[model samples]
Target chain A: MQDSEDYLRKKAFFDSLLTIYGRKPVLEALQDESIPAYKLHLAQSNRDDSVVRAIRDAADKRNIEINLCDRKALSRISRNAKQDQGVALDLALPHYGTADSFLNSLPASFELLALDGITNPQNLGMIIRSACAGGIDGILLPQKGCAQVDPLVIKSSVGTVFKTRILRCKTLHDTLARFREAGTEVIGLSSHAKRTLSDIGGSGCRIFVLGNETHGVSDAVSRISDSSVRIPMQNQVESLNVAVTAALIAFRKQL
Target chain B: MQDSEDYLRKKAFFDSLLTIYGRKPVLEALQDESIPAYKLHLAQSNRDDSVVRAIRDAADKRNIEINLCDRKALSRISRNAKQDQGVALDLALPHYGTADSFLNSLPASFELLALDGITNPQNLGMIIRSACAGGIDGILLPQKGCAQVDPLVIKSSVGTVFKTRILRCKTLHDTLARFREAGTEVIGLSSHAKRTLSDIGGSGCRIFVLGNETHGVSDAVSRISDSSVRIPMQNQVESLNVAVTAALIAFRKQL
Candidate 1:
């Protein structure tokens, strides 16, 4: 119960930080007074174009700080410098942070989903939409081995990425361990599980772990799960798409 | 029972027709003799490249007829002239025809999903994969206002398009009416339905209807549906992805 109380508290901090990349999105974010812009980063080698000049003028008018950085530094921040058009912005999103911080503020009754190595940005975005739409409490996303949340992801999520409760972590294995320690059942979804999702526990404060598209749950995380469940299938279909599987488990009856 | 028996007999005439576009995919289809190739289409203006030569030779060896037509004619055959690369093939795929032909083959214990106005190829492909994986009897794909089963849709379906049963109809509303007359329940899924999916009837040869991504079910189809069902969501989420909704209902147990 305490674990969930902590998440609800952090949920209050929704849309607290959003790092938007690319020229158009950055400029749009800067122009939209509604979205809080902290700093604007520009590649030092950007060509003198009217759009670039316009972006700078907008930042100046808004009193948003503009930093000139090398391509590498900008790439690290934007994650896609080639497409970034030498522009990026750091905005204050409402609720987003480390898994620990999110867990500390979790609600007493919640359903969380831990994404494990989902490499496709479109799939990741769609999964986030499903999780949010299903009313899943929070999503735990590892920093590595997955597609970085970028413009494409934002577009595919249909802009829901901004509002969804997202908890980032360095590694999911460790996060699953932490979830287990909190007396929350860390359930892993796999095609080989003996029990179906209907037979597994979904109620209470629990986390459902979905793995990579090609590979099922990783061995490391699968080893520590309280129980593993499979979505029932009729054909020897190998498995359904990972995002679709997440939807099934996310929307499954809690009881 | 007699309706399904009629379909089983017609299933023997598999792959009577298929129109596949794109250079690589058409070439691949031509090389694979296992797939019946009825005709090979190429633009008269196409350069006589090595790969094109190779394709001609393969088709010659397979006794498949080749048509060298103008760009417009080839595009008409391929449906996607820009991406077709001047090459297309008409092969025979298993189990695809008008809704009347498909319904004649459906089994007594069967589940069908009718897609209405789902224009995205990726979503259509994903839905077909899920339907096949979950053992759906047939999918009603309208001839209008939806993504056609093109190369992208085939790629997204991961080649399940070859084996999955597909029922093509002129309009979804007409298809729903046919299902109704056949004593099959045409259940349209809506986010605003009074009864949840759990509360509705799902057994005994029911066709679960899904509407467009942006718009829910078409008014015509909705009016003809035996009952409307909603997937219960906890979070004030408006709706799930159309493909994911199909997956949930396609795999929902029949009693």
Candidate 2:
């Protein structure tokens, strides 16, 4: 039993590690003092160019472990040999946690965003950036049906992917059901809804759910939602971009 | 003098035509009856697939001219041999007009969005989509220092690029100056502004300026602005995404 618990703990730790490749990305990650930096992997064949030198210096300054390995080992570590640029860095995302843990520590009144089947990485990153910058407290990200955190997402977020609190779940429907059971208000966004975004009042633990690009919210997820609100649109517009909708929700309080 | 007038008119007509490539995009354009269809170009080597048949039928229904050309001629027409999928469509943008002409017909107490050096095609497309869907009347598009309308932009706009009223200008600074002279209120969006977006009243013709991705408004443009306002942000985020900012401005009336 003890061995099994140890293995689970190690697995959880490794799961939180995001291995970002490319020389510039690694150097930028090292430069940001707030991002939790782990071990750095460098290909042995990489020449000591200025950027490579800068990455090494930043790593040394942060006291991060530097693993000089062969090209094959570096490729294995990065999993993207063509774009890794002979370097990779594992970052321990301090703000990443599970939904259960996040709910336990939630405040009495909070506004959160839950993404449902957002497949575009750019939209996901922009949503994260807006949620982090605006009045949103946390983001509920599902493991499935959503874009994974990739280099494009990182770029879109302007590196705020490391700064925002992401509560991961196996599936959004199940997690939203649990949140509803726990007395949290789950609101789904739909274009055909009668009520506008301003019609809803902020008074409790609310999770504003944004849906897919082509389709709105999934039927199963919509069934569990407490209410639905639409952003007021003009000019016969059927819908706003998913990321733009997220921004509107994130900054709704300020508005 | 008559020949010169005819030549000028022909040049203007040709300038407004946008030739979009790719099989799916062309078919989608043909299906949307609202879009002004000019001509259709297809490669002779294309097989009679379902999509190609659909495209031909849609063009036939609309009475649009179909130009069947060889592979080399089709490549020259599309300019994207690899991705055009042996099809291209010419669309005459009905809402596209010059800034001077748009200003002459400006409505009283209107809201407008002006792009200043937005380089990313995706960002430009999202901004146009938001501005089109929201309460904004027109978008002042500078001919310089901005991403030109392309297939990626059309994809990002979700076809709204053809619907929105784009007031073209040679440069933003000169046009902004001309608008200021005509008693239009020019508001620049900056993070450090003391006044929030809500602080401004909703009277008179207003043009909100959104700046570049990395930099805020250019110094030359900022100097001529009547005032500036900022979106209220939290969590130490310096600024929102340019497209997000545009959405907020476009939908500010609803808020």
Candidate 3:
């Protein structure tokens, strides 16, 4: 019973460190100031010793406990030894602007991205990073059928996930309808659409909905879409990767 | 010296099987019409197994000799357990019509795709597949910077690679010049273009040039481009994955 409790405590500690794997992510978490980090893990055999030293120096300044582990142990925890050169800090997810707060903070006219069933965390992170870069007001992700913001995803996003306002919606269809009612044109991307992305000019506030990798936007979501558009292709290729498709449409809409 | 000669002979046998792997890319070297096998390498343990029976039937019909190796020998030759699957065939690159031939066959006005420096085989395959589905005329891959069509590419293309015309150009600049001479409008996609893809509209025979993933188009290519276009983004996301971006433009051209 005592061992189990210790295990649970370790698990909780690890869970709390999800927000602080990458250098940029950790820095962002630290900037929040209110979020407390208890410990930092540094790999002993990192080739680039500068990053490790900087991390150690920062931890020292923060008065956080530092533990040095072997490369194998760090790899085991990160699940990817290739990129993570063995620096992970225990930190909390920051309480940035909430979805509603961000929306309210945005200018009256703005564009947004709504992701439906994009389960690949790398893809999701890329999409979010793209959305943030494109000046998207916020992102709406389905509560389910979505990859949680994991360490790899945070790395992939280059730390944009920390800054982006991500809202988890119970039902994508209902959420899309809400956008539509709020005077936002909810466009769903489909391969069979008669209209191209260019056909829909960027004249009004818009919300672009990107679908899954295999099965596209659900029928329920499609039914409520103001318009469905497709990216053109040649040479008999059926579809593009979902994240790329989203970037194309999102950028096209902004244009 | 004798062993070296034997190795060369075996290699030659596999090389000779390449011709049978074209188009359908299924086993055609086997003698039996019913059994599907181009070439069969068998282990001693399964001398009378179904796999061996199939190979023998095919070999007998095709009048081809079957090479038998001990399990250890076969394992060494195969390098990986990939050989344990009991069948491995040499698959050929899918046949693509010549650009000139495809152009002559097509109507005067049609859309075309020109890839700048797409190095990923999967991306190339997906681009070809999407291009074919979108009804584009032909694909122009720069001889210098594109991925070669191999077995993996054929599989990824899902057989569409067999139908498309993939022209290998000595120089993309020269090719773009040729397209210009043929009244094909050369458009380059970039992040900083003054004109958006939406502004381009449905025009005459259009040739879209997609660049490398990291760097946009080279200055030389950009200078020769008839029009430079950007896909506008709402957020600050820099770019989309090359294949996905290509699909979007291809679909847009179709629309």
Candidate 4:
């Protein structure tokens, strides 16, 4: 019960952050003091037109620091410099940071969706919404070889990205290794497994490792999984979308 | 057993159709005579650019009928005349037609996905892919409020559009009426139903009704449904994506 309460508080903390991009959107967000503004990024090349100047003035009044970033740096932060309109803002999300921290703080009985090679931003966003709605404990999202967290993902998620329990990691392999060390059974979702989910047959804390759209779970992640289970399906269909599969598992009553 | 055999033959026939759009792509498809071509729609305003000329020439070589349509007519057929580049080709798909006819021919037992007010083409495409992969008997897609079959939907379906069994309806209300008259249980997949899927027990000739992304199953259709069931979800997540819900229901193990 204590862990559940802590999870709610942590989720509330992350949900408060609003990362808005684009000059006009950021300006609007900044002008509204109710909207929390953590850090503002501006392209160094921005000529500070009247609108830009007004943005800087608003930030000055709010005591929000403006970081003039090089083109590459701004693009890195904004993800889409063309649409960023020479500006971006990152609101605070104290609870959403390192996967290691989140995993270490786990209450021992929880469900996690560890993704591998999910490249489409839309799929990533939809997955986040489903995971959050399905009440998964936390999402272990690897930074590399996956779609970067950006505005498109946010749009696709319908703003659920901020509310979802996101635990960022350098790589999922290391996180899975640690979870294994802590005695958590890692299960890879595959359509080919002889055993169906019913075979797992118990109320146990599990990390459901999802994989690429075309390929099943990565070999490295599967190698560490205690076993693999398939969703019993008809129609000779091979598999469901990673996000759909995630929804099914996250909401599975007996899981 | 005979009905199953008939269903297989009907599916095989529908799998042959290939709807190709765009001037360049149509030309390429026409050039490969091995590829099927039912009809070619071309805008009357086409100025015969070298590309347009090539498309016309390729169609000519393939003995494919060319319908010189006005801008409005072309746009209606292509759905997006701007991107269609004044050209669209309809390949043969004899089995995919009126939902009324499909319902009339049902074999007393089947699984169908009856969609209500699904407008997003991507969602429509994804649903088709999942339905096809999960081996649904047929998809009852109403023409009035649902997303029209288009290039975006095709791309999102990853070309599974051709192989899937699609039953087009003039309006979902009328279609639901017909299904009810035929003794098919119209099962609405809502998030609020007291009867979880497990509580519903065995399925028999179920047409799982999937609703809009936001509004959910329309009232008219829900009234017609014999009973409504829900995929028991976790946390407070109200619902899964319409496509994902379809996948869960369409592929649900006893269905």
Which prediction has the highest lDDT against the true structure?
Answer: 2
Candidate 2 per-residue lDDT, tens place, A122-195, comes to 88999999988886888999989999777888988888788888888899999999998888999999998889
True lDDT of residue A119, candidate 1? 90
lDDT of 3 by residue, B32-96 (tens): 24333344455565547654566567556665545576767655545444424433343223334
How high is the CA lDDT of each candidate model?
A: 0.80, 0.88, 0.66, 0.77
Worst 10 residues of 1 chain B by lDDT: B8-17
- Positional deviation of residue B181's Cα in model 2 after best superposition, in angstroms: 1.2
Report the Cα RMSD per candidate: 6.7, 3.7, 9.8, 7.8
Q: DockQ for each candidate?
A: 0.37, 0.61, 0.27, 0.31
TM-scores for all candidates: the values are: 0.77, 0.87, 0.62, 0.74
Model 4 over residues A1-255: C-alpha lDDT tens digits? 999999988775655454568776677667877556788888889996998998999999999999998988988877776788888898775446667676667674888888899999889988987787767877888888788667777667655666577888888898889988887889888887887765664466788888898887899888988888888755445666777777767656522
Cα lDDT tens digits for candidate 1, A165-221 = 788888998887887787788888888889878786435888888988788788898
Q: Can you tell me which runs of candidate 4 are displaced by over 4 Å? A: A1-20, A23-81, A86-89, A231-236, B1-20, B23-89, B191-194, B230-232
Tell me the TM-score of model 4.
Answer: 0.74
Which residue pairs clash in candidate 2? Answer: none
Maximum-TM-score candidate: 2
Candidate 4 C-alpha lDDT tens digits along B84-118 = 87888977754466676676578767888988999
Which runs of model 2 end up more than 4 angstroms from their true locations? A1-19, A41-53, A67-88, B1-23, B40-57, B66-90
Instruction: Highest DockQ: give the candidate number.
Output: 2
What fraction of native interface contacts does model 4 preserve? 0.40
